[model samples]
Target chain A: DAGVTQSPTHLIKTRGQHVTLRCSPISGHKSVSWYQQVLGQGPQFIFQYYEKEERGRGNFPDRFSARQFPNYSSELNVNALLLGDSALYLCASSFYRGEGQPQHFGDGTRLSIL
Target chain B: AQSVTQPDIHITVSEGASLELRCNYSYGATPYLFWYVQSPGQGLQLLLKYFSGDTLVQGIKGFEAEFKRSQSSFNLRKPSVHWSDAAEYFCAVEDSGTYKYIFGTGTRLKVLA
Candidate 1:
């Protein structure tokens, strides 16, 4: 089976613009989560969805949002992008929510804000 | 409050040498622990995880980790290091009572040929 897949491997945007990143989870997986990895830092959780519902949200600003689809895929939307938002956006899929379930990740979408 | 810490920001090891990466966390209760490796320009791959039962867990890529509840630590180790193992390693813990993961800053390993 294919691993988690992400679209638009790379993206470029200017400040105040909007960007939408997409992710398709591994087949048969029902949980998808979003994370932001800054250069030289570990990934920071942004959002998590399970069964097409928002399960958890990180401490990101309101400008950042995400939603899960019926197919278990997910999209992360960022409005008013800032230079600080320039980072690698990663998507991870898991069999289910909770412990003992490992997450598989996609290559990630590198978003560059100019 | 909960957080993960990787004290070593960078480490250099010779190929065929033993390797160890340290990870420490601060939380009231024991939580799920994990080690992930990220190659340059790549997403993280699960190296290993410790949830329950065994204090020591073996993962893919010839990696293993030990969870010490008394030390609040879960450190990754490899019997023999390879050049391909040079990458950024992250330690994460399940956020208390949530599905979120709290990740440490990361340790970048540089393998010497």
Candidate 2:
């Protein structure tokens, strides 16, 4: 029973460059969500995908986008990254997008934008 | 608009001492509340959650939280803290019927042995 797993544990990119972070949800999970955690702050929701469909989005800009694959994996892509984009990107998954279902999170990807 | 506030930015306590972390939320209806712990360079882990029924909820790692409707507060508590318990704690709330969650700024706990 593996928990959520994310790739490219760390990444560095310059302004105007784009980066993609991937996540594989726990087996048999069907919902994947993305969050961004800045230094000294709690994570902020970015997007959520259920059954390969976009279910919700946060107050993020259009430059932040995500999609869930058929296998319930997900990718979060940030375009034209700015210095402020430097943060820890987290991926969480739940058996279902239901009330009271707590999300399980991955170790997260540390993104540094210069 | 739902939101959560963790008034304390950081806290320091000696190991084996009692600990309490405050959390308050703003929402129209009764909200689904949760407490999550995040260690350095790690993702958030659920400590406990409150939906309804009992106001007090026990969680993993010997953590517990009490929900007070009148105060709009869901504070986490532990009888005795351990060094390994040092981490960032976040309080989150979701609408009664929605899956969307709003998290607090988080409180960083520093345990001194």
Candidate 3:
């Protein structure tokens, strides 16, 4: 089966602008999570949704939000983009929100803020 | 809060030589440990994971990790280094209650020919 897929592999936005990144999890997966990776750093968790409900959240700012559809696909939304927000956004999926289920990742969407 | 630490920011190893990357995690409970590799301009690929059972767990790409509860370490190791292994490696931990992963800064491997 195809791994998790993310849309708009690359994106450019200006300050004060908003952007939305999409992700489709693997077939039969019911959990999706979002992460942001800056240069020279590991990915930081943003949000996690399971069964269309929010399950976990990281230390990201309020400007960042996410939602999951009934189909288990997800969208990460960021408002008032700043130059600091220019980073690669990653999406991961697992069979469920439980232990022993390693998440599978997508290539990620590179977001550039100007 | 749970966290992961990779002391070596970058490591250089000769091709065909053994390789080891250090990872230490801080968690009160038995956390799920994982190792992931990422090539330039790519997402992370799972190298291996350890949940329970034998402390030594094998993963894809000839990678293996040993979970040491006493040391709070889950260092990744490979029998022989390959040029293709010249990528960034990240160590992460997830608490059982919280499924979110806490990742280390990462270690960039440079394999010399």
TM-score of decoy 2 = 0.97
lDDT of 3 by residue, B1-113 (tens): 88899999999999999999999999888888999999999999999998889999999999999999999999999999999999999999985576988899999999999
- Local accuracy of candidate 2 as per-residue lDDT tens digits, B1-113: 88899999999999999999999999888788999999988989989989899999999999999999999999999999999999999999975545867889999999999
User: A1-114, model 1: which lDDT tens digit per residue?
Assistant: 899999899999999999999999999999999999999888999999999999999989999999999999999999999999999999999999987678889999999999
True contacts kept of 3: 0.83
Candidate 3 residue spans exceeding 4 A from truth: none
Alpha-carbon shift of residue A112 in model 3 (angstroms): 0.6
Per-residue alpha-carbon lDDT of candidate 2 for residues A1-114, written as tens digits (9 for 90 to 100): 889999999998999999999999999999998989999988898998999999999889999999998889999999999999999999999999988778888999999988
Candidate that beats the other on lDDT, 2 or 3, i.e. the better one: 3
Would you list the rank order by TM-score, best first?
3, 1, 2
lDDT (10s digit) by residue, model 1, range B55-80 = 98999999999999999999999999
Lowest lDDT block of 10, candidate 2 chain B: B94-103
Off by over 4 Å in 1: none
**Cα error of candidate 1 at position A31, Å:** 0.8
Query: Could you arrange the candidates by DockQ from highest to lowest?
Result: 3, 1, 2
DockQ for every model, please. Answer: 0.81, 0.74, 0.86
